[model samples]
Target: MKIALIGAGEVALCLATEFCKSEDEVVVLTSTVKPSLKDLKAEIRLTDYSVENLKKNLDDCDAVVSTLSGPNEFYISAHSNILEACRQSRKCKHFIPSEWNINIEDFPDQPMFSAATHEVVRNKLRSQNDIKWTMICHGWFMEYLLPTKKNPLREIGLAWAMNHGTKVFDMYADGLQKVTLTSTADAARAVLAVLRDSINTGADLPPVTHLAGQTLTYRDLFQLIRTRDPAWKSNPVTFVEVLTAIHEGLKANDALVAIHQMRIMGFTNANHNPKGKALEWGTGILQGLRATSVEEFLDQSEAGEDK
Candidate 1:
């Protein structure tokens, strides 16, 4: 099977690296080829996301997976072009949008402004039936808990919930609400499994597939960090305080508003998968691909540091 990966960010790089391990052909489409992408064993094409450019590049591809990231308008525009290109190509039937975050279905156009952009893309996908599409919601990327030197993932500005360098953390509403965390490596594997299953069984991918390496509360995460370094500290923020910050941040166009909203989401258990969908999907369709736990990741980070 031939696959086209749009964007060359951390998610796309991980997916491309994993997909290349199989006999399937992997093509990475990006505007700029970063140094990290040069090491991957895949064909790389540098092109703008214009509809014509995408259509030409997407030719003969079996499926297209987008890991594009940018401003809200940029995301919507690029995805729109990609979707149109898929339609015009007529061969690429399967598409996985760049929704590697929380389940947007539950909180449409809330918490983050980008959620509204995703809703627009979903509506466009729904309007057409030719392309089979699915969105993967794996909550937060677990690598953020570690510093850049300790993990392969690219640094996404402003670490969420905690800052390892500063040894400072934020606890939302007592820090007892559960949130799912999945490492990028595990997420890439899960996506590859889903794609393989779809190709093998000739079945449509679920609208939303959840993947979790582990689920724990903020307090639990603090304990884990403290276990690594007893000097780590937490600054508790009440529910009302988070809400107020989000409101004020939004009004001021503060870049940190998204992070504030994510804290609220975590505090309210909005980031958790209570239905065990990820577990069932993993065992039944993913075929026992075990995800790396938070504990194991910390251990790996420690080992990397020692070396």
Candidate 2:
């Protein structure tokens, strides 16, 4: 199957890297045609933000997947443009928009403008009949959950903020709120499965397929940490004060505050709001699809760092 991937961002790179090892054809459509990207195994074409170019690019492909990321307004126009192109596409049949995180439709009152734009794109997809679409309702990225030199866990924008040091520290929830997260690696695999099924079986993928590593909370994550280091401590915190601080941060135009709020939603409202049963329905749907648990991923990551 030929796949027209639109973007070269993190998610796109992950998908391209995996797809290159397969027999299927993957052509990346990017606005910036760089010299560095010239050596990639996959084909490259200029998207130039034009529908005609995208339609031509879609001519030979069986599926179109967008990993483009930008402001909500960009999505409102860009995604809709791609969908419209696919609507008139001579060959393209499957479409997966850049909806890599939690399903936006679940949280009707989500604060971020991007969520509203995603909902708009989704609604547009629903009214179409020419192409079939599916979204991976992943909770959060496991890479984001990990403490990095770039994104330290102590920054408070993490679903699991326990690796913050030995302060016997605090967090925003009482800790039983089930926070579900998945790896970009896992998500890439799921995307491949859906696309293959759509092309080969000629059947539409589920409207939404939720993916997650584990349904553990901050408290459970802290306990997992305690297993490796006995010095770790846990304490509950009032969400109101934290939310107040977040609101102030938002007013000040801090991007990190939006990240923090998303983490909060994953920890608190994820279970009830984006009510999904990835564990139940997604368990045996795909062959050998192992959804890594939080403990497994963290333990493995720590050991790798130690090595």
Candidate 3:
């Protein structure tokens, strides 16, 4: 299918890369006024991403997938413009907004990471007669916990989370929550699968989709890392320390602010846990890696293959 993807960040890049691998004609829409599409593998189009130009682009496409982000100010503005443009064009079959994160409904009181504007846009799109929409709500990225080429959290041989070698915090509960996580590749594949499936037509949509390598706590992750690397077994970070920092940050009304303050910039659960039964996806990422004890995550982070 010919699909137009909005933005060109990590998630967008991952999605476009997957679709291109599957032989889908993917067009990346940029508002750079005059974007240099030279190295981009996907077909490139330039527009201000304004409502008017967006309509023109949609006229030539079957669907639109937005990887636009809410935290990035410019991306959020462009997302709004795209919504308006999609509404005016009235040609797109499916519009997937950038929502691959913790479910908003899962957290009724926390506003730290909710996409308010995107939700509004989604509501407006659903109410319209011309377009069909679906939101991707995969939990946190598993790589966020590990070191990556893009994520510089792992430096010299160490990575950091809310805890600093003492505290045990849950991705959902107090070191017991079983939240879902997905690899960059698998998550993208799932989105493409839905887009390619003819069954996801019209207003009716899949109620929810969950992806994960395994459902375990931070302690479990620590154990995995330790089992992989021997160094982490000695001075491992504890859940108590991690939870204490998060609670203190929340008490100060600066939990989100803390993300910026940390040296390693990545998103993970603070303290509150997700409710209800979660379906697990992606058990392949954890196959050869062994970190079943507190000594595991630290050891593996220092000695395991750089995932």
Among all candidates shown, the one with the greatest lDDT: 1
* Candidate 2 lDDT, 1-307, residue by residue in tens: 8888898765677667767767888899998876645656899988865678788888889888898877777877888889878877888978998877664446534535366677788889888777898877776676655654633212443434544444353455677765566766677777777688768878767777776666666677567767766776766666775677688888999766765566456345553324354634254445667777766777778788898
Pairs of residues at least 3 apart in sequence or in different chains that clash in candidate 2:
none
Candidate 2 segments whose C-alpha is farther than 4 A from its true place? 34-40, 103-105, 149-170, 230-235, 250-257, 271-276, 279-285, 299-307
What global local distance difference test value does model 1 have?
A: 0.80
Q: Could you arrange the candidates by lDDT from highest to lowest?
A: 1, 2, 3
Prediction 3 global C-alpha lDDT: 0.55
Compare the candidates by TM-score and give the number of the best one. Answer: 1
Q: Which ten-residue region of model 2 has the weakest summed lDDT?
A: 150-159
1 versus 2: better TM-score goes to: 1
Query: Poorest 10 consecutive residues of model 3 by lDDT?
Result: 263-272
- If scored against the real structure, what TM-score would every candidate get? 0.91, 0.83, 0.68
- Against the true structure, candidate 2 reaches a TM-score of 0.83
How much lDDT does each candidate structure score?
Answer: 0.80, 0.70, 0.55
